[model samples]
Target: MTSRKAEEIQHEGASGGWGSVSGMAKVLLREKPTPASLDTLLHQNKPHGFMCTSCAWGKPKHPHKFEFCENGAKSTLWELTSDRCTPDFFAAHTVTELLGWQDYDLEMQGRLTEPMRYDAATDKYLACTWDEAFTGIGATLRTLDPKSVIFYASGKSALEQSYLYGLTARFYGNNNLPDSSNMCHETTSVGLKQVIGSPVGTCVLEDFETCDVILYFGQNPGTNSPRFLHPLQEAVKRGCKILTFNPVREQGLVRFINPQNPMQMLSGHATELSHMYLQVRPGGDIAAMMGMCKHAFALDAARREGGEDGVFDRDFIAQHTSEFDDFAAKVHATTWHDIERESGLTRADLEAAADIYATAKNVIAVYGMGLTQHVHGTQSIGMLVNMLLLGGHIGRDGAGACPVRGHSNVQGQRTVGISEKPELVPLDVLARQFDFEPPRDKGMGTVETCEGILAGTVKGFISLGGNFVRAIPDQEVVETAWSAQAITVYIATKLNRSHLVHGKASYLLPCLARSEDDVQASGSQSVSMEDSFSHIHGSVGKRKPASEHLRSEVAIVAGIAKATLPPNPTWRWDEWTADYGKIRDLIEATYPDQFKDYNARMFDAGGFYRGNPARERDWKTETGKARFTTPTVLSAVGVGDAPGRYHLITMRSNDQFNTTIYGHSDRLRGLEGSRAVLLMNPQDIERDGLHVGDVVSLVGDAGDGAERSVGGLTVTAFNLPSGCVGGYYPEMNPLMPLWYHDVDSKTPAAKGVPVRISAGKKPT
Candidate 1:
């Protein structure tokens, strides 16, 4: 039978309400013409195609005939759709008219076919030649102060493209580089940088197979990273203990049927994933970890008292770690009462989790945005590291901290020197390699970029790819700053809200998608992506270009550099754009030991695994050891108001990844058609005298005396914490105050917004 018919048979056997499958079945079962109708309904299949930009749910390491998730499939279908945004389409519609459309609606319009320039007079966008657009952009940049320009790169760009963009920006004498990492895993980087002297994860994907125990913290692999689910499933089947700690009970964590496995899919057999589940309160991750560590220390002490060596790795601690006395003292000083109250988990639960860790020979701690989007997000990650260090879990088979990255190449971007503060060695090497004195002074991060923009120090923005306006906190302030820019250049595949919030002279430069072949003067090109496991793999596209006029991000950056920068004697932009191998050589030269044969190694099966200091149990610090950070105040919790208001935790739907929505459906939560809904505990609803589907207004201070409120939200009471409310982000981002951010990392406390929920009609 056809794919549609097979999917229908599978969906019937699968659990309740498969939205995408049901939607597909409706189209398939409908009566119409035969082959002709199918041809009309389906988009043209092009060679070198098939890449999903929506979620990071990639195909497995080993190939499968059908390897894609529900969200991934939707993203693929959307990317491969026949819809086209031609020059005539823009000529017919005004920018203002397009601004009125929904985010999903705008993107569904299809890939932009040509370069477009904003027309202030007609309030419309007009077609512009590539050279004209570049020249205009260059002129705007030259007019502005170098510090005024903000170069924002996304994870979608290739290594060559990202390196070129960074080169152009730094060469122009500014480092206001803000990327998608600012929104998702900036806290992880900041946290790990302070503790481990590195920003990326320390483990490889193969480690999962051998891990004795896997502890998941506030991450849902089934939706966020579906490819991870299979490995997790295999681990569970092999009797590896799987533990999950999150406010909500994610379905994927409980059990998942591998869609790619024919036997499993046909037989409807699902593997039980999580052996133990602990629902910790929102923003209480640090407390939970501290509690577990405290219990483990007690157990170790008891074992020592009995004249036997405890489970703790004393040799590793003495050889590879520092500040053990302080770390142990803090844990010993912390009372069980404080841990229970702060974590919202009982002493017994913490003890049980500690017991499991103590028994497991190999353990892997995995976390996501939930642990990194709080007031003390960075501190939370440090606490987790402290826990891992206590048990000597570092640099072993299947043992290390794994921070699941949202985007595909976020790690690779950071790897290729797309950082706010460049490392000393890289900076020195880049200067020597390019024959220019690179800026020794540090530059702007996400928070700093916002501050610069608002202060009018930043006058221009060149976004490689991303919805920077919508993704950042305080939408009103961000949009206002964006509008005030002298020039805002967006190099993207499709339209987003960022394109609508234009500057004085905005230009949208359409580029080829990542899955599309990049055939330049040098021939076909391949981009490298670093997975969460620190494996650097090559992803070459096999699909045809969306449009003939579209250029690769590398070429676009090169073109802009040629227009803007003076001809550099040392670096040749044209040569680098011609072949990505040349860029790899530069990268390898910059970091000699790390990327020895960067080009050749990337082409090897399974790619090259970058060395993580933590993985080697070799602490790269001034003291030459993994220093255990002392927990000064574990009870200093940031919750909502006193006995009345509840804390609002912003989350993403199952069908959504970051700010990119695959569709308007939350399969796990059972919500359909819309994303404007709040989840609360049934007890909280009863105590507050609220009912299901009751319209409520969530009010919070926007700034000054102004209050930002999202009204007309249906309150659906579920199994969430008593005093906590969970809602989707971007929609609920208005409730997050601009000034309210982590002091250390400067990441917005999106998970801990204090709001007074009331029963009434929402104010317009």
Candidate 2:
């Protein structure tokens, strides 16, 4: 055993000099310098090979020499690693033994080599052939009520695979398709459509260049979407004002260093990214936005009285919007005292922010999980749209709503019709094309899926690539619900905690990674994906497969479809798998307006932009124009008078992406060797009578009447607000109740979890 001093972890400015370079190098060192590793890194985000599986941010039209970020490199190396998990490896460990392993440890064991079937008697996963696994799954699905079966898609699945998955579900006469988007961006989809007549973003990547002001509300781009930093850094160089409003002062928002720029690396001086950083309280984004709009309305009134041009865009409002009168009246009625109490920012601070927006000619607004994972997430987005519409900072160059996506192909999945509602095109078109009437009934989303699991309505579950057990809220309840299923099928690449929480019958189908070569009867194939800005592009894998037994995601879906379907000519699973170009043909045929000449445009170096009418000044809304909504004023729900109660927010560490953990260290936040630390304000620590490194137990205060608690969490002082605390998720996910969700979108209130922290574990 080695003994040494506890090394203090140093937090640096986001991505510069040796920090980012060393971080990338460290991941490669652990996996050990493989030739394919370098090849995959060079081929990433290039026209010649596959896109980066890390993020959905668009790549430059011309492309860079190294078109990936530190996290991107980590994700690529993780997929291309030489390590393998064979059947022998599983034979040695029981399911009970593997249950004790950490999430990071499970993924680090490397790519799964073959298919597996759970044996409850031995509590072990035994080896099985692909045909046997598919036959069993098919037989089980044939017997169950189609409405009781649910299909789930992960964000990383290619559009070709997602299209087939959706088709298979519809062919089987159910639309129970719940995706990862239901967890992260469901609010963006539901809210944007309600306000702007579109579910996708209105701005492209290039808009970052010309926007004068960018309001980054409730988002941390530095760690979540690092490629966004390039555009932000360039925007700052051009004298654009970047404003941040979040509970914690994230280091990425404070300053950024460009590792690719040699002069900046040599100078060792980081560029200040944000003009102003307001540390709003947890669940305070809605209140802060409302305050800004109220102040802007006041500024407009005062300007008109002085006989000057007012900030209101009267021409644009008259020609392109509805419900302006009612929205304006609500803004006038909101009180300053309520805003200040909820937002944790003074009236003056809101006025200052309003002044910045009033002076700017063009502005862009971007947000992430902070705005979406709330009880009032849909209303929060409406408030954002109301403010932007006040000054006509939309439907023009460098001005629009941009809800930056966290996952690589989440946007792509939605674009290709991975939805609970399959009404992208009319039923007539789908019926004529596929010879089957698609299900018109509304289906389950992530939250509704949890409800289905608990109520015993959903008896069968099939996941394309996500760890559903860990990703969903209400950990204990979800585990029980998942175990109660008759059959559960997971098409995955590696071992996850979800595999351990199995049903009566479980099947683990291993698939090829995005960076690996996928060969079929039609030769090498490339999969298409849409970026956050709605640009659809093709990605071809260049590296060899990790295992000979591993198959492509498309092949697995096709095999299952072939085994299950009732033998119809129109449902040609084999033909679709023969050539993915044929899949593009079907997509284009179904939606001619959006996917015209899909195959031809797919190979274009810059990719093709899927048109957005909202960005082009086209209104397809109910009122034939953008609509302004008068959202209700909701105050921050305090922890009440309880001594140790606090507003707790769940967050992802810099080292992890979603539930996939790459390492134990979070370099950006200076956390290492552990992930169970709670970040709280020093003042809150004093008020609660706790010091650093004190183990505590946390219980939910949502009044759900269900017991929700997490224990063995160590307290750490952070620069958070007085009443706000932070904890890493999946670990803290148990504290979130299943019923605490937005009524409109069914997205869980992840960012607004109210918790009471106390020393020692709870009594049994």
Candidate 3:
């Protein structure tokens, strides 16, 4: 065990309680002054107010007085802050000069105010008219092949915005649309699609009310989706056991005191969340899942041989599933020795977890990027599905798969049609409705976009929202590709590092935040979004616009589309922007069953379920049944390959969301004033002959012949599985080679970067 006495970094007991209150107030006070700070929280997350612009955790059917979390508070308050980055701020600082600033400092300059164009002569952005900016983008794009244009989407936009953004890409004749999901939950989508015939999870938010056991895998609910704790707290109170498997014993999993509960807050009494927390190896989820599958199969066989009831749901399997025999054989072939070695957990640990799973009447499997961002992320995610399918967890009262998505509407973005790979139904419908041949060629994802940029094929880039450069892995590859592009356009609310890396005809177009009012030609409109539970609802921006010059994302996308296309007869971009309902109607026409009553249902206070076919046991797969698949690999990461090689897991801070850092404090781990730090086992620290505060460098040891290194990371001794280390994301992204990714999903293996420790100095 590591002692906090000598270490500079400090971590407190549990997550939430009075600490959350203090953190919320600190964030609000930092952003807003006097009464305005209090005003910001008044209508937030309310019926007619804006949605919390953080995680995609669904709002309850009946919301509490306080519907926001500490991190959500940071996101909302930051967007509502009075700070603005005007044209003068851009005039004073050159893009080259701003490149020197850290990511935290770059965004701290506040929200962008107007449209700006990049001038190579002065190397500074100057204010330009919206028409002028659009014309430049359209003219440049017209000269290139449609396949060379990349449309990057962010989940921050409303459902209407994302829908139109994708449609616009298809209008220009290309399926090369990639969004944030390609980086995070693409594995969940692909994995579930293959098994249950649906890309989305089958579970709803209310399913937790009657759950018996929740197999939580590699997700930190407290920081990523804090509102999820409400369901977890309710589950614990109702005697539902949560078995958590992770590389580190995160405070979120240990305990969480709801600040809304006055008694729990005043008394400092936190509800214990996890009944059994297993510290698995960094990228050991595949092995851990197989361990449970193996045990369950063995238990069923022995019980059946004794002429007793078996644990497996034989009837459900025979009726609704296929390929069970092959899957079972694969599990039987995997020995306990291999499971124990790869998972970094003993056989007893696996057996104990399996026992809880087998006895539970209703179980829900929940996971996040920790399971998706691995070399074999798709296989690990499929294993979770396999474990649930054995007991017929799908379409049950309280049991199903719950993939906790990262962004506010990442799942919705994919559902509405922002994808590099499009399903044929939508394409057929879109093609028929518009009377144009939709491109059939495979488009580019984030990694593919980078590769294309290097090969001098993809030249133009358009981003709806997000810090694309910082969020992607292989910083060198993306940066090198940026200079080769002919044009880059970013429609955003604030400045990020990606804005500084300009092309010959780069642009920065400011848009309204979700919390701000958006009045089109029709009237003040409400934007809609679909949550992780497939619940679609409207978010009316109650607050005033940050700047008079700012426009809504829906309008910005429509403008770009109209400008790029030569005024086609079938497309009515102007009318869609005037009334977003028309856009939603077109969306319904594209996906009739999913968006049945698109406009009417969006305004409901609790929203309406979009409905998943798999949840109703109506498999849309080619075989008309759920299919079981066996993983091709024993482990997602290699173990004990060389001396001093540690599996480094990149994690997020409590004070941050995705790649956006609000402050220097990481309240969950109790670190302050620095984001560049590495966490290691105390025993490993001793073995490496390093103290708690020693500076070190992580040299990428993937043996890919790529010399990648990240220096100036302070070492902190903490409790974790041996041969595993933890560090903040984006900072450690340099060590992750672009080629080291999942073959199936092409998602970067961010959770496990094999690295060797070396002496380093703090950046001078």
Q: How many residue pairs clash in each candidate?
A: 5, 0, 0
lDDT of 1 by residue, 67-114 (tens): 445555454545545567888988888888988887777886788989
- TM-scores across all candidates? 0.92, 0.97, 0.97
- TM-score ranking, best first: 3, 2, 1
Model 2: ten consecutive residues of lowest lDDT: 1-10
Candidate 1 runs further than 4 Å off:
1-61, 65-67, 635-641, 701-706, 762-764
Model 3 / residue 320 / CA error / Å: 1.2
The CA lDDT of each predicted structure is 0.74, 0.84, 0.85
Candidate 2 per-residue lDDT, tens place, 89-154, comes to 899999889989999999988899999999989989999999999999999899899999999999
After superposition, the stretches of candidate 3 with alpha carbons farther than 4 Å from their true spots are 1-12, 33-40, 305-307, 638-640, 761-764
Write the number of the candidate with greater TM-score, choosing between 1 and 2. Answer: 2
Which structure is stronger by lDDT: 2 or 3?
A: 3
- Model 3 root mean square deviation, Cα atoms: 2.1
